[model samples]
Target chain A: MREAKKQPGIAEVAAAAGVSVTTVSHVLSGRRPVSAATRALVETVIKELGYRPNPSARGLRTQRSESIALIVPDLTNPFYTLVAAGLQDVLMESGYLLSITDAAQPGRALPEVVRHVLARRVDGIVLASYGATDDDIASIAETGTKLVRLGSRFRADFGDVVRADDVGGMHDVVDHLLARGYRRIGLVNGEYDAQPSQMRLEGYTRALREAGRTADPDLIHFGTFSRAGGAAGARRLFDSAHPPDAIVGGNDLIAVGVMDAARERGLAIPRDVAITGYDDIEAASLVTPALTTVHNPAREIGRTCARMLLDRLAGKYDDVAREVVLAHRLVIRESS
Target chain B: MREAKKQPGIAEVAAAAGVSVTTVSHVLSGRRPVSAATRALVETVIKELGYRPNPSARGLRTQRSESIALIVPDLTNPFYTLVAAGLQDVLMESGYLLSITDAAQPGRALPEVVRHVLARRVDGIVLASYGATDDDIASIAETGTKLVRLGSRFRADFGDVVRADDVGGMHDVVDHLLARGYRRIGLVNGEYDAQPSQMRLEGYTRALREAGRTADPDLIHFGTFSRAGGAAGARRLFDSAHPPDAIVGGNDLIAVGVMDAARERGLAIPRDVAITGYDDIEAASLVTPALTTVHNPAREIGRTCARMLLDRLAGKYDDVAREVVLAHRLVIRESS
Candidate 1:
């Protein structure tokens, strides 16, 4: 059995790190910023000292690894970053070590995520994949391992899913646009193979129909879920003879792309045309006109996902799969 | 001792996932966007099938775990995000699993990082901390583990070090400020204990001396490396009886904070007050009036750090500590 070497005091760690006992304590206490080198040194010393917290507690849960893996699509997205923060908070509270990875990285095959989970022999997995499939899900559930899916092609029977009401959120954005007197609204969407985009598109059409508005096929464009892709789609829409009075991008990055194209064409937002985005990331408020966007409640989703997984791992929800649907809100800002 | 389970064929995984062979293969190949649920389903099945990559290769490296861990301070910062990407790219090429963690999480004691490093038994570590010390570096060095320090306190003997020429970069920014005829220059810096801030302060003083300008005590402020902190620092400078016409922010986040305060005060950038930031993060270009800042070569630093660690692990540089100093560039944008 791989047992912890021995108990080591904090003073020893500090001395090993070559910092004062106070500095070591501060670094471990999360009270202040220790120099980077000092922080690293302390990390090494802790490992060297085999400083395991509470052996009795660890011994009781020797059956449990106290580790989980979270596979997200991309780290560049602030929305995902928020999810990571929220997830970490919950997991840390549960005394679980969270291992985060990206599904979008090259060679990051969906199977590799499984391979890692198995290799690490983690207790659970949370997948906020850009895209995953039915068969892929069945594989995870078949093992009886605790798992939760965040905003993907999930059916209730597939597994426990924690997602935002993107469909309703999009409807709210369209309604807000209509109420603001923008009739010809446009939607530049990406990730056609993903659930968020499909749901968003549904809401867009549903809202337009409810308002008794005519739908112009020309107003809709498709592109990748990125700034450049959004810009490309917007450029196409703007170049068309009849453009939209307002455009709601699939996400914030896409919306930023539209804003980029607008700037290039000298088109003023809310004057020549208005623009909105999904996922009210940190950058949304910092942009020139401050993009009006829908709050996807990523942090809540993360919390819900982590909580649900921990519950299952603890045998709290052993009888059936669990599900949670987080709410979304349309935030009215300068752009719209 | 534990050994990898028997290798499962792709066909078995497909059947277990309840997907067609073609779909399972496609999911693994990354040729198309497989739905998220399916991706999850497939991952579960792969694990259920006790999947292993290959036997001979796995056996050959059974004694040599190809896992490397990276400990960064904050995930909210885009600079660290880029570093993660760069490090992942190289580590992946070397057939090593890169495990990333943040050293700044609340209750994330310094020991926990080391504990994780030891638990995973990673072959090496890369520490991208804001601040670190000599003792810390020496301790990590004594472990006989390959280590690389990214952007922190350093000495010629502090293991292997990879850092930006922050002092020179700061000098360039100061010279730029002087060239724009701003006599009363201020600096709102964060992470007083970190190398970046100290180097930037040094650069500020050096440029002023070269330009025959005396440094004023009233023109300097210190705060945490955060936007709110930056804003607070800037508010102080602005409230001062003799406010500077120009100011330099320790990093982009700080600069943005300063810009926020200036905006609230109705001070037009480059008109009423010129502001600049360090670490030209992604948001620097997206923010209103863009930003003038130093381009901290984060990705290059990450690559360098990872490469050096891998080299050490492979016995490429067994005797002496290696060092690499990445260059920094000043990017002039509208904010300045």
Candidate 2:
């Protein structure tokens, strides 16, 4: 493993630079000021010799892993992947490594997951769009791990929460559909228990009332937050005696499902049944008809979440219990 | 940080089980023979107390990090995310952690990335379709870092390689398209430099020749392995003086682009033009007029790649280089 010969140690660096060990340590650790010429000479030697500080040794001295864990519900979802990528971009810049875990799998106990991360002693954590029981949240908080919630707002008093404008974004999608002469619009929503699902539904109804359109409860269908769920709900809508002329999906996945349902039923998109989805995931544009949907700043949410966690770790815990709401927009395409 | 009381150690277990420290150590590490009754007693106490052997202590004694690095080209691609998830599933079971890195960013230095991973002293590495240059490979190999290539084959002496059945899968897709009575098929391909891209193109030409169909050079388009590239190629095909009746995308992203182009141009799928894609990613089904394409076990590929690296690390390197060729199948959907 040491084919290139052992890298020079700090002692060797100090000797080579003709400086005392104490002075070299002060210059390298930035503990005290050193002469400009001496500092430059030491830095040059360090760089030229390719000296890398041992992580284990530094970890022992700093009592920090210089790493963080990103816990998400699922990675198969493009939205989560994009968010994770965003988090990596910011965290990697600060010389911090990211360890990712998917909490969606069964049989892998959450407590064990927490313990494993704790054993690593990461400086912080970024939880992305995943639900945890109240007890779980309390346990994590009590463990003294700096936590930041992304997309899912929960236990406001426990940690920093970063989210997108889901309610407003949904309203934009619904209003756009109405403005496009789409009447009798059907809604394929997510699980009613989830916060995003309820908020989106509220936005949908608000937009309908503003348009002087009576909200039809029968036209609303709730299912899992997945493509299959959207397909199932869309099928039910199409089988109804009075099928809707257009469908509004809770997110891009559901909208994609709505598209699938229309195809299976031999319905022409935007002609026989216009469809709209939210989140504006990468798939939204790739799908046929390029789903007209709302663009949620997933990557930005991740960056903000990481920065919030970093701030907390830096002892800025009293920075108020604020919610960082990033901008979202409605991207009009062919679907609607 | 150690606020909780320290858990009982091996000495306490020996005291409780009425055994010597050596006997307990033998039973725990399976290093030496111990009476069955004594072994059972020690095991019971170990399980009852939920005692975990200290990984750091064990690592110190074994001279290993008990960790590995997984280098992928991109994580925004759902395919790679699934692969990462799969690799994590297997590695986590063995008490090994994964460090994931995305190498697709422009101006990203590979040597620095390799050095960073090596600095962490990861026990092995899994390079996923990264197209690593010879120098990069040589540098990592020189460090004695066990390496495995996923979704790409390397020189026989390079290391373990896991590749999908690209040629066979492409042939199946092209045959299905030709059987649908479509001629003048356009090939939307990925970077021509990639091995899979070249193999897939060969399959397409072979199928056309066997069907007594002339391959039109003008119908071939090459782009990056992304949905936008696919869409761009589809647009060019549509603008051509004579547009093809069908398009075969090298992968799912390109196929998605083709769908978007058709929708933008108001071309009815299958009626005006039929399209088929490869990979059959999760998006393939959710999109409107679900894509007809080939399915590659991306997650399985990742899992297999990790396993091979583990085997290599366990001193199982042999003269007969092991190669795992996973199966691929064509999935028919509404698009065709």
Question: Per-residue lDDT of A1-336 in model 2, one digit per residue for the tens?
Answer: 213355467788888899987877788789899999999999898888767665555664565666788877777878887787778777766767777877666755565566666656667877663455666655566556777777665455657778888878888888888888989999999877767788788889999998898778778999977889999999999998899999999888998888889989999989999999988888787677888999888888878877887787677856465578888999999988
Error in Å for residue A49 of model 2: 4.2
Q: Give model 1's share of reference contacts.
A: 0.13
TM-score of each: 0.80, 0.85
Please count the clashing residue pairs in each candidate, in the order shown: 31, 0
List per-prediction Cα lDDT, in the order shown.
0.78, 0.79
- Root-mean-square deviation of each candidate, in angstroms? 10.7, 4.2
lDDT of 1 by residue, B151-249 (tens): 765555566788899889999999998898888999999877877788889999999999988889888998888889889999999999999999899
DockQ of 1: 0.14
